[model samples]
Target: MSVDRSYIRVKAMLVSPNDDGSRHLVSRNAPTSENPLGFHRLIGGSVELGETHQEAIIREVHEELGARILDLTHLGMVESIFRYNGELGHEIVALYSGRLEPAPADEGGTLTESDGSVVPVVWRPFDDADITVPLYPAGARNWIRSSLT
Candidate 1:
């Protein structure tokens, strides 16, 4: 069965903070024309058919990072409308907060996507100044910032 790229997608993502809550895990994306410097986003993926957003988040984290999420808490939702590569895309994202079990190293690591492409994963401080690579789903970033204060 093929999925429609133009249709708005429903996704579940996690805001996984490190032990001290000073940093969060993010996946670095390749540079696109819309964002020449590229960008970073929280780890998680699409909510599959018949899956709850919470269940989707757990499955996605395990699949994307081979890690488990604990103490999951519903953060909120955000609508993302943007372009990737050259195609317009839209997503309604359900966000959650949690901690990663066996967190990735401070030096960061790589994670393979469902498409088998490997991307770098890193722990970034909330105050990171590289605005060129802003955290995506702008609303998600705002939520994280508000929670940190």
Candidate 2:
């Protein structure tokens, strides 16, 4: 058996403002992650074969957040070289920002993985991301922060 390596991947940052008038970023707890941390811990994933980056984002939102994005504007591309568990990994991930049309009406309060994995999504202000979540691809965190400018 051979390892399946993905040289390319795509994702989206579906964000919204909380009732307290603070912004929150969203991310999906990856299937491989056993314990995922904070808000950027909301919804996202890789682009499937023949699927465009935008399509993957849409699919991810539906599957993870149960919410459709009214619009997704390209934020930027993030090239990342990082190590996880001591293994070096590199990726050029396409990043985009979308406005959630409305709070997801799904009965579940937290996002669920399609594979039956469940991790709670805890919303935190942008300023709190560092203290709360362990965002991957370091560049993505920077892109998200810069896009708000």
Using TM-score, give the best candidate's number. 1
What lDDT does candidate 1 reach at residue 25?
Answer: 88
For residues 45-121, write the lDDT of model 1, one tens digit per residue. 89989999999999998888899988889989999987777788899999999898878888758777888888899
Candidate 1 residue-wise lDDT at 91: 93
- Please report the TM-score between candidate 2 and the true structure: 0.70
lDDT string for model 2 (91-113, tens) is: 66667766665664333357666
The top-ranked prediction according to lDDT is 1
Candidate 1 error regions (>4 Å): 1-4
User: Which pairs of residues have clashing backbones in candidate 1?
Assistant: none
Q: Estimate each model's TM-score.
A: 0.92, 0.70
lDDT of each: 0.85, 0.58
Worst 10 residues of 1 by lDDT: 1-10
List pairs with backbone clashes in candidate 2.
27-41, 27-42, 27-43, 28-43
Angstrom error at residue 13, model 2 = 4.3
